[model samples]
Target: MSDWPPHPEAAAVPSLSDLLERYATLRDTILSLENEKNELGELIKAALLRGERAETELYRSSVRVQKRLEYPLERFREVFGDAAALEAASIDRKKAEALARAGDLDPERLREIALVKEIQALVLTPKGS
Candidate 1:
């Protein structure tokens, strides 16, 4: 990110203190810019609702309504009966994993259905010679 004109300290290897200061500056700048962007986005959404259609030389904005259905389980089951409520049921991953690990279920099938995900960040890499 410091690559455009190249930061002054980049001329030589930056000390850890210099890197920490630069990191804080960039982080704060990003947060400020994001806040500004979110405020503008809310304005554009409101304009779209008023049928004013916010547009710029480079971009045009349109609004779409996204919806989700949530039901209170006991009340819903009383109204719709058990079969309809069956559609809303989900497997408990931890219990399923326990069974699979014990060889009572196919681990591969569990993996497919569970769709577990991991979050990772790039911390370091070996330099190429």
Candidate 2:
């Protein structure tokens, strides 16, 4: 209503220091919330185990209970046989890295075998406190 376009100088620009501070504050808040969420999740699991019903009102909430069977590596191999164990075993990256560094394996081949993804991250260091 007032002006169709605002002046460049009139526009507010956030400084790097301000942005870094905000990022750090947000990271800390997210970590705190995650911890709270994990604690609440455990409580909910307990409630579900105790036969608490899922509610659907202003906020729809449900608890899913699942039973999982975990087998010991050595015992599992003994019970299911070595062929079954070999089939279930995942590729070990550390061993592969060692092999590559020792010149026993090609680095390019190793990279090809593993899922490679490039990520850019912002690193902030605080001034002397």
Candidate 3:
């Protein structure tokens, strides 16, 4: 018989203390990875929020400009006495109402709104407008 105590597997397995130490190391590693994941998630969320806010501000500015354009357009019609102007306004009102109903107005995107108006003005080219 050997001097050491007999073991079923010839004592090849690691000691209890060694196993405990390995387990602690693995646990700490998992925790660190989790923390890193959380930090990255927070960073992504904040960046998205900032982008949304900027887009919203631009849209709001555009809405204000669009309102100003409407006033001038109305005044021009009042002075010029053009029938086509009234018809164009009817179309514009319908479009605005449709956009509103479709949730596509996005009153916060001013540059895009202005571009749309400019394009419409060019395309429609109301007689002598």
Candidate 1 residues lying further than 4 Å off, grouped into runs, are 1-11, 67-129
lDDT against the true structure, per candidate, is: 0.56, 0.55, 0.45
lDDT of 1 by residue, 12-115 (tens): 77678877888898899999999998787677666666778544455555665543223444654465456544644533455445555787556674454333
Query: lDDT (0-100) at residue 71 of candidate 1?
Result: 40
Superposed model 2: Cα runs more than 4 Å off: 1-10, 58-62, 65-129
Ranking by lDDT: 1, 2, 3
Write one digit per residue (lDDT tens) for candidate 2, span 1-129.
Answer: 633234567676667887787779879999999999878767765665577754433343455434322334465446445664465464345554565577755667555445543332212223331
Write the candidate numbers in order of decreasing TM-score: 1, 2, 3
Output the number of the TM-score-best candidate: 1
In order of appearance, the predictions have TM-scores of 0.45, 0.41, 0.31
Collision pairs in model 1: none
